[model samples]
Target chain A: MPPAHPPVDTADVFALLERGRALSTPVLRAAVGRLAPPMDTVAAYHFGWIDAEGRPADGDGGKAVRPALSLLSAEAAGSAPETGVPGAVAVELVHNFSLLHDDLMDGDEQRRHRDTVWKVHGPAQAILVGDALFALANEVLLEIGTVEAGRAARRLTTASRKLIDGQAQDISFEHRERVTVEECLEMEGNKTGALLACAVSIGAVLGGADDRTADILESYGHHLGLAFQAVDDLLGIWGDPEATGKQTWSDLRQRKKSLPVVAALAAGGPASEQLAELLAADAKSNDFDSFSEEEFATRAALIDEAGGREWTSQEARRQHTVAIEALSRVDMPEHVRAQLTALADFVVVRKR
Target chain B: MPPAHPPVDTADVFALLERGRALSTPVLRAAVGRLAPPMDTVAAYHFGWIDAEGRPADGDGGKAVRPALSLLSAEAAGSAPETGVPGAVAVELVHNFSLLHDDLMDGDEQRRHRDTVWKVHGPAQAILVGDALFALANEVLLEIGTVEAGRAARRLTTASRKLIDGQAQDISFEHRERVTVEECLEMEGNKTGALLACAVSIGAVLGGADDRTADILESYGHHLGLAFQAVDDLLGIWGDPEATGKQTWSDLRQRKKSLPVVAALAAGGPASEQLAELLAADAKSNDFDSFSEEEFATRAALIDEAGGREWTSQEARRQHTVAIEALSRVDMPEHVRAQLTALADFVVVRKR
Candidate 1:
């Protein structure tokens, strides 16, 4: 089949994301600032805007990718980007809320080259701040005072519920010795896809789009999220630490059951059998702290030899194509459509 | 001045609460049932409705006092109790969310004569379930689908944020050697008062009350919460473990800076000095696990001798009076006003 549309360039994606970030950052900060002190200070530090002492810092906040999607999705629904700021802020707050709590649950100490909130502050404060931000997200959506505010709140809540469910499943997965690829994908769909779908559809809802357009945007976001997670799984195993800001082979060292690892385990080849033996031996020894760098590298090579890496990469491309098809379902303005396509491409193709 | 109103009978209070619970319990269950398992199982266990094995069990969920207040407030605004079901459920869900997370943070193994969610499951599931419940609360409110739904969400969010803030402050207070009475009261107001006020006002808003009436109901709830917390502080120090489902003198054993303790520390009397010396010695010893029953008894006696017990009782009564006066500011039907009055009296006078 001939190409349905020209591929989106990386430069266009960055420029569009930069524009969305500029508009959404101030609104997000103001919403977070509405929380009382200590919590506000903790949230600021988590956002990479300030140090623990409340002084301005040089660290970067996250890419603001979710909010950018909200803004672009809003524009795609034929509304001004400003009209989507509330939805953008809501999604961003929820995203950070999950991040703060997830770090505590996983016992992670760092993120984006900064100490995690639970590390700088105590776990109790991190939990409370995550809650405050979650509540603040609902408050901001209601304050929008539009006719669609009620619907927006409902949508956000639905997404949040799924997000929590996904987290629960992910935590449970860590204890299980074997997990199917289907189960892993379902978990990712809830964990990542739900919020991203909310981010995409919320803008359309706020813009008063028809149900057909909103559904199409949500579909685009769901497939994009799956592709994003697949690519993230690949990066967890093989990407350069400098580009990803994560320790080399960090996932393998932690014995994480990522997509590729699970796929390799399920493949039933000789490499897969050997990989299982190695993992089982590691579990029995329980000496994760003394795991050498070479052992981590060997696990990565094993996953590749079992064809898990190739399968995951192919799955990412498949999902990316489906995401583009979903975007094509909605006849948005050419520029807006192109930006959405570019963002989806960036999600699957990014180095970080 | 003479008493502004007749004293409320406790029987009447329970009757009113029974009616509200009968009306609201089914709705609350249905809302919680919407969650996916094991979240549903965890929530059910947290609510004391079931065992960890998912079988029916004999356990009390709670007093259902907040839901009763919500329903009564709705009736005060000339609406049926059914109209307040959403608000009641929302309040109850948020209450459980706080309880689940607080139990994890405080490391309390028991609540309501049963294992806490964290103890029964684990901290990760407890945290995830709390997040799920919080989201469900918002979902319930938005599903009300009235013009007031937006306003209700905003009100609920505000109360939830303060509740989280109060929890954060309470955690921070545990590390401080001294906390002022003023700070203690402020924290109580945020922690307990905010949710009670929301419970009182949300019904009025749902019933389409004017701002004045809603504010009066909120004020009543605020004072009632303070009075309730004061009574709880007394119970923490002196109540029977059989009644409170907590260890005898639990707060003192943990060196909690509750309202009465803070007030005593600020009194500057000989008894205060003695109490301070005892507490300082305990801190220096740093042997909490081996703290004897005699030590706990002695600490309680010192606090009472310092006038903390008497002062707290007087403060509770004063707050009860203020709460009644706030209720008088609104003119509702005679029966509804009496129910509200009776509930307030029950709150202040309860032994548990």
Candidate 2:
């Protein structure tokens, strides 16, 4: 049978999610409102709820998934839903902050089928918007107060530092001609896994969970992030752009050092050599029109022949299995456990 | 006789300054220590305390001025010195965070006679270092755990938002061909004034100051910032590069829409028209080294004729007067008032 939409039931998650949204929206709005008019416009553009004129627009944003994960962990750890809500808002703000800045650094023009903040507002404005989001994220963390402050603040800071480390490594890899599989995994672990681990750990901490519970929750989140990133990598190469709304093999065009590419490089054979040639060519090609479709196909075949796809998929499944095992170690309600399992499965298996 | 250094007589402010530096150094080191081994190496270089290999180097960093201001305000507000130290450290972190990122955006190559962070560590690593600084700033704020989570967090968030708003305006002004005197003031008010204002306000808030005292301190800092920025603008055009270590009239070469430029632009006439031509020529001048000193002086003369220098100095004096008036409004020790006044004098009169 096909997986249910949203994977988990989301009843509990959404309840906390809505509360966070309600709490944060006004706070965000008030802060932005007080800013100079131009900065206020940039902030609105980042939220995707307003046009440059500050009027309401199509208003679709990414799924507040990370925040929900954080809130759910906090709830499952036995904290009141309200108790963990500030962190919910904070993690979401930080995630969006990263997205805004990352899009600029990567020169990504489109997100959610619309112009990125930088695309519409320009790069400088986008950078400031990201900065504002980052500042607000910290402010929200501070709001979580003293009892939860120690752990949550520490986790958030570490996560933020790791996120930048990951991005730095990712960008550095592009300039280099070679990379190892271990380097790629470590990069991904810092970039994607740091925040996920923080989300769950913060939730557990705020929920009054014991240290052991927090550790187990953190493990679950770490593996979940790895699996999620793997699925994202797969989609970058193989998923339908129309469904994912991402550029077609955008990573390939950019010669991104993703898992599959890194894996093929590590195999060290003729196929790997061919992959390298394609990468070198791609680096020089201003437009895809310069490369023949057959050349693209040949490169794809080389990656497959080197067992890059299979290796990546197997690693992803291994992470998912480990995540499930970690979740099992936590003593939560049966329904919550099932929900988390579903969420983990969905992360590893999703096409988009 | 030359004025006595206020640090000699201002025992409380001096002690707080020492304590602030002590608290900040450890926190900053601890946070940077957690960076990935490679990233840590780069961070060390960026902090001016180490070589590329993370070996200790001379002349490590600037005076912790922002933290000192914060700590002084906290003490003046009657908060226990220990309780307020964290807030002071947080502001310093935020200041350094801005400095690191600003160097990247401004394409600055040198700081304090050494290579700028980005010049040494590369842009990607430098960006991460800045992000780390920002994260640590938040961590410091979060360390002030108390039952008043909501209010405390709100204040921190508000201050951070102001900081970003100021930065946005600063970046935005760089690209503008024209800006008003009011707009320039407003921009600096956010960019420079806001953080200084927040430094005092955060200290006051943490030190258990009455809202009235916070308001007074905030006003004092705000006006003081205007004086400082105006003086900086004056120096940018007229000061000795040997003393400032900045290119003489470099702001003119860059066609910066600073306070003097804005004032000159506002005082439109034949002089202003000549100033505009100078700006146009600057825009086309590809090589700073190629321009003769005679031509640079001639162009600067046009700006001076347009009343740029005089108007800016007059405005600086006006702002300083307001700052002194605000200082009078604050009910503090006579010695503390004298110390703050001395600092204010230092800001307005500094050549570098």
Candidate 3:
């Protein structure tokens, strides 16, 4: 057995993410560099390695949480972190692929405090570049030329399918008259949980870990992803716009059937009825284009008063605890477990 | 050696395509069936298996050329056609994936004599279902659980990347003032040639054909695809709309920088100059929306007068010859060679 280091603090989670970036960035860049012209530039811009003009820029590439999970999972399987770099890069590519397409589908103009790919380039390139990245992810894994790599690729593709399914459901829900809390949870689980579950276990699979151990890690990640999404949902509604870089009561404005709204609607109280009526009216209002921030705030207040906020917060905490508890089923160094625990804590309780 | 059959005619080529469909459709349907909810229905609609209302309808699905090529390629490599089924299904999925996305990207309203996926479904489901099909393509290949499958998956992904790259160039060309014939040919090669080449050779690869044999088949496919696209470009401008299932002078109407247009522009004749001026005027024309059928016909006449139509026809013949010559480099049954040659003839000369 490997020697255990001291318990890791929350700061180590950032270090793990940084290390993931450091390790996976070079390979990721190399793989992306293989793309044909204009696509190479567009992908580079999307990754924040270059400005829209193709000039170098220091931009906020997302925190490499999935990659970090991959590397740490590999180490947790008693393998070198390098064994996981391919898995890390593959998952990261898949993540960005979803982001590029998602931003376009949702018609979001900004990501990471920068203009989204579709906004900067166009929707066509966004679709094409996203496709290229997904292809690259599969190429990267299969190029490893091992049976284990094939297995990992299958997991990645399965997660990708689930992610797409979730997006379809999410889009469908926008036109839906009502969505159950259970349906929302299932969608979120597929959208976010499946990918994270793959990220956390794929490296170990690549490292030749048995199915049982990988399953445990996958369970940990699935719950953590749900928790992470719950926190994001909270931020979408109640968190400060300054902290979240989103508009106040963003989910309320969009009428997203997110966890909080679905749960609140399912709660069946007078406040829930009020919240539902307000949302229905907002959705059908002739003055929808003229709906004021104050109106949106009123809707947010109704959702909050319906206990959506508290229920979501408690759900996040519950998922977080379950995620932490799952670590006990796997054999890993104490430091890795502590680090994974700390990351879950950060995800569940993050302000933004 | 297998028994050599009678020399096959054009009728046999359709039979080949039908046989491919017969073998691959079940597997393809099964893979698509695995998709969730609306995506399943959406994909079925796109595949012409079902109408927009989710009722079964015999809509015009594609001719299954890629799958046909795959099965023929495996047979040409001295393997059973069954050996190529996975490759066939994988390429068909990739082809449909590109179609689903490209229809949205190009904003085309109709395909295969019916509404495109994005026209019937929303753009969001189009994107999601396209992504899911692509993921499924990779999954299908990798699940074969062999080194050959892994190798085939790499080839598939590489071609997929090139396809995306080609699409990017195609979109970029729309905004540019000029696109050289060479540049246009390169884009078409990536957009149309890469995936076709993958389809034709991937089955051979999966059949464990040696690199040299696969390379020869790939060469044949590459040339055949170029020939096929040249014919398509010709049809885009000059063919019957009823036969081609497109608008009259479709390429000129969209200002698509297809082969004929680029070649005509580069010919530098008086007609070329006139054609160039008219196109520039059209691009700058605020009345582009009001451009009549007569104006479009005028552009088509100028392109024809400039020898664009003849050049494209000659290019198609040249490519067809090159493709048939490529078949002589590798030894297969005489009937197989004849069948392959017949398919090339059909593609180079098809109205659509």
Candidate 1 local lDDT, B1-352, one digit each (tens)? 1223465677788887888789888998999898887888889888878897888886878788899999988999999988788899999999999999998888888888788898889888888889999999998888777778778778889889899989888988888778999899999999999999999988888989877898899999999999989989999888888888888887886678998898888888888998888777777785777988997887788788888888888888899889989988888999888888888888877778
Q: Which digits, one per residue and each the tens of the lDDT, describe model 2 over residues B75-166?
A: 67766545556666667667777777777767777766577877877665565677777776766565555543233345656666776776
What C-alpha lDDT, on a 0 to 100 scale, does residue B44 get in candidate 1?
Answer: 87
lDDT of 3 at B244: 74
Ranking the candidates on TM-score from highest down gives 1, 3, 2
Note the DockQ of each predicted structure.
0.75, 0.43, 0.76
Task: Return the DockQ of model 1.
Answer: 0.75
Q: Identify the runs in model 1 with alpha carbons over 4 angstroms from their true place.
A: A1-8, A52-54, B1-7
lDDT of each: 0.86, 0.72, 0.88
What is residue B29's positional error in candidate 2, in angstroms?
Answer: 4.1
Question: Whole-model lDDT, candidate 3?
Answer: 0.88
Candidates 1 and 2, the one with greater lDDT: 1
Candidate 3: regions farther than 4 A off = A1-8, B1-8
User: Which candidate has the highest DockQ of all?
Assistant: 3
Candidate 1 residues A7-118, lDDT tens each?
5586888887888788998988898888877788999999988997889986778777888888887888889988888999999999999999998998877688777899
Task: Write candidate 3's Cα lDDT for A35-98 as tens digits.
Answer: 8878899999999999988899888888678999999889999999999999999999999999
Better of 1 and 2 by TM-score: 1
Clashing pairs in 1: none
Better of 2 and 3 by TM-score: 3
**TM-score per model over all chains:** 0.96, 0.82, 0.95
